[model samples]
Target: MLRLFLRKYRTMILASVFFFYLGCCLTINFTRIECAFKTSSKNELETRVQSLSKAQYVVIILSSPNNEPKRDAIRATWGNFVNNIFVENGEIINKWNHTRISKQSQQNVVKLLFVVGTLGLSGTKADKLGNEQKRYKDFLILENVEDSYKNLSLKLLNALSWISENLKDMKYVIKCDDDSFVRIDLIVKDLDAFAPSMNAPKLNKFVTFKEHLPTYKGLYWGYFNGHAEVFLTGKWQEKGWFLCDNYLPYALGGGYVISRRIVDYIAQNMDFLSSYNAEDVSMGVWTASLNAINRVHDVRFDTEWKSRGCKDNMLIRHKQTTSDMFQMYKSLAQSNGEKLCNTEELHRKTYFYSWNVLPSSCCKRN
Candidate 1:
């Protein structure tokens, strides 16, 4: 009788055992796959951070989405070079050193990349931009903002956010337009000499004010304007929330340098910052509220509504044509960094920024 009962239930018991074993195997495989995916994601982020750490200074060039030629000119000119420092096996090496494949390394690269905005209308230029980015791997596209003259403030916002996300470890960040000409070597020389002094804001020991209370901290270096009147009606008017008779003091957008702390501070408060008509003005307004800020106004940066002429010592010059860029690069490269423009070409008369005069006439021509 026992043997007959076992035979009757044999098929059901075998089926139950097989199903249990199959379920256990599937569960184990799924968990392993999920863990692999997570590990891969984490590793990708770590790799990005490690690679980006090689740059001491990064220049974020604001470019137009459709202006591929402008970007190309920049690439062929001053923005073409790469000099990154890496530490491998307790030794310092450069990116060009192809001798040793470093298993473990620390990267510090000083490089430049273009930050462009999206084209809201069609996909033609957008597709081209995507392909260009893939080729160079140096583009930071702001998907939310449209690339237009009026929307530059938003473009700047997204650019700084990108820096905060990827290149936050860099010592300094320089923001400039695509048309600007940058003499990076000269700028680097000044930085090496005056970095500590640059970091410290000019404060008086006798007077205690909120602006000067902070010590050597946020350094904002560029050509600054404190008396730009608010225009109510014009092509470059301010209808935004910047309710002021004069715009807050800010470095001109052509080419300005900011310390890492400044970038971090801006990133931390990105969500609440107001949008202004001009990106430079927006920067000034947003930074006006910070407790610690060191504003360094230097005339060497020829960044303004117009160029202050071609001075030999100028570090940056805005409103350069594509042709002008090629010419400038050729002059500098051929003369071994002595001459600026061709001898035949006319150099504009240089002017000074009268900061000591009346507040209303701060940047007036002498």
Candidate 2:
């Protein structure tokens, strides 16, 4: 009787093992199939979506559906004000066909877009976003990806893909968060001086002069310096392991401008590039992977919780609320809108810490 019981127990264990292996095989197959489906869906969407034509520079504001007030605030203040003008005829024409009123149109070369992602399969959130898009006709929606913090990298890729496909002619593409406020007058003045004509000279070529030198074609301008470590665990860790120990020298995600060349490179390599959930860091990785990209540092793009002292000189200020945007615009107006603000603190490096995982070397306070 003991021998019979032992044989029966062995048979049951064998059956369980067989079933578990089969389940694993099925799960693996299902995941592959799901990934394939998602890839196809994204490809289809990419093909069907239309691109915005014209515009020398495109300022893409990464926003959400619920942030209508913030969007409106931007439009009311800096959004509506184009190139230091306050609007005489209430109509300024640029390449993107954005029919809005602002100050005098110096070059009328900048275009604004708010990018948002889908909420779910079918719900009020999705509906609200659709309605908002239709009403404004300014948002670029990511149908394949969900709108969540973890999926920001994918959202950024979607934007890059669209821009590459559609806005290829635009000289520079500035990726900004909804909360970040840009002094358009400053940006336009810089772009104009750097790349004034179609054959504008390319700046920032030498190794020693990258810090204060102006850049033109093939330039990746932002507030970033050396590499930061990729955390394998905790809040900062998601898919960071795909990258090496340190993230590549890329711009901060809050606000950075990528030249047409980088955008083209990103568009071409989107399929094979590993997706790290952190958009800014992932962008650094992407640029680092490519050999031809010219990564130039400009401290004018501020991404700090507490900004530096050069308020007037800031080209872009992150972590702004609607109220904050209004106040900044007012300040800009008072400071003689067109005169380039002092870059006294422009070269000063600012440090930001969201988690304690980052090393002292990641961001050096100077």
Candidate 3:
């Protein structure tokens, strides 16, 4: 009888312990979930700007009044190319104007904002003495920020705010100049492939430049003037190449992409000092400061695409004529049909390069 009573007591004790442990686990999990929820809520304001549906891609170009001619030219060419090429392939192209975008479709559209500064004076008048007088407000001017670097910081903040307010549902955000032309089909394929690749970094998006250095003493490569001298330090010096990770804080030129999370973070926290020159470099610095990793892709940007032939697997081509942009679009649309001869040859040369290169020099040691 005593043995039976002891067995019952032991079973009850075991049950009590099991329940206690389970309760503790449930509490911990609930706490973690709450924290994640808060973080998501904070980031939602920015991430929600990404529209994932109207089309798979969003292209952003910065244009000024001076570039209107080029814009018109490119638009005409694209109109022809889209009609002749993309429509036949069943690929739909939608113009992402602020008014026409739907709430649901807006959520899927990528937001691209071009930040174009005016070069010429606006609204000038001759004074009574026949001397030319310029109006301050009419001039494209930077805010009076601390240093030149701070101007860019402020520009990004303002630009991002404009984007968030106007394009609340975009999925991606790209900032490019008027002279750049992206191979939309190639960019879409690359992003689609990159999105699922385990090798890609979860944080810090891609940045393109001539070179990078991590341990250099002065400003990072591409920080100063466009033609700044390249410094040598660390293993990169020996290899005669710059890595993106080292000088991310001072990146410049071409353009870059920002995921919704980072954009939201920046929008929420826009207290950085402004920089007057090289907004792109300041952006790199700002992103680096946020603990984001700026990655480098192998795609060639900011070069004459026509000279190299329009068929390369490159995601973007810089310094393009309006005609070149249209031609490239047409080529991509017809890629499924009889392949264009030049494009085929260009693809053959470019397909061997992989976008999976790592920022760390670990492999070099081996």
Candidate 4:
């Protein structure tokens, strides 16, 4: 009887060990499945955006939730500068609340959206952002991700994905940082005029790269140039992806406009592309991968101000202080071209020096 009891106990131990190993195997498999599901969900986000139909143009601004002052300055200034005057309660208001661009006669309608990600483990940021969104109705919040400097590329991917899904009908999509001042007035006007050129059978020779004839289809516009060893460095390094050589010709990241076709391409191919911590370099890599993409240079869209002075043709300025934004907005409101240009010129001289220059053959500001 004793021997029989010992054998039963041994059998029970074996069964317990077997089940433990089985549980471990199942847990590992479940983890992988969860990761794959997250990836697929991210990929499917574009499909969702595509289903929402497209718009004429979308100015996607990258902002963090904590940066309320910057966002407010933008909306109060350049955001509502174009065709945004309307009468509300017997008073003329320039705020987006009363100003309607959707019903305007112009085909180059521009919609503004601030894209942001959530803070980790804290719901306060999301709540604040939600309230802000309700008040402004212009934010595109990425709920699944955390907001961090390291996530700029991911944030961009989210922006492109969302734009492709919701605003795909837009002729052009402008991606700018919150600190950027986009001359929306000029941009809308120029895009309206340039629409016909985009639809033409052949593209205007706006920008040419390495003897490659320019085409209008995959137009990526910004202040572009050749830079040697311009890839991310230090903490922003891309790990396995080393750029021992010069960076391929690409736009500066502070702000740029891309056609709907390129947005669509990026939206579809996002899952397959490798991401770098530096959002701009990652953009360069993705565009470089596609033959159809063109790195067009236009001085007006100064992603990094290098001009000795701001001329009348200045369109976009980056890295402005909050005070500068307000001051610039006041100048814009006054339509004081001379003052604005002088201020911009002063800013250019103060912030940047001409270390390198692009060839004169590159595209001129339109």
Winning candidate number (lDDT): 1
lDDT of 4 by residue, 1-366 (tens): 988887879988889999999999999999999999889757765554543343466888888878999999998877865455333453333333323334433332457888888747277766787678758767778877688878898999988887776664677788889888788656655565554233322333332333234454577767664553544567656565665455555577788888888888888988987777767777877887666554555556657634334555667888777887778767755663324443434444222212134433232332
Q: For residues 1-366, write the lDDT of model 3, one tens digit per residue.
A: 988887879988889999999999999999999999789745753443333223333445554434555655545433222122122133333331223333333323232333443323243311211121021111112223222222444555666655554554454565555566654433443454443121345312333332333421111111112222333444223222243324333333444455555566666666654333445645655555443233443324433223344434444456666766666656644654223223433321221112145323211210
The parts of candidate 3 lying over 4 Å away from their true place are: 1-58, 77-155, 196-252, 274-276, 292-296, 300-311, 333-366
Which candidate leads in TM-score? 1
TM-scores for all candidates: the values are 0.73, 0.68, 0.47, 0.69
As for TM-score, the candidate ahead, 2 or 4, is 4
Tens digits of per-residue lDDT for model 1, 220-275: 77877778887788878778754567887678999988888888888878888887
* TM-score for candidate 4: 0.69
* Candidate 3 lDDT: 0.42
The Cα RMSD of model 1 versus the native structure comes to 9.4
Regions more than 4 Å wrong, model 2: 1-51, 83-108, 119-122, 195-217, 338-364
Specify the poorest-scoring 10-residue window by lDDT in model 4.
347-356
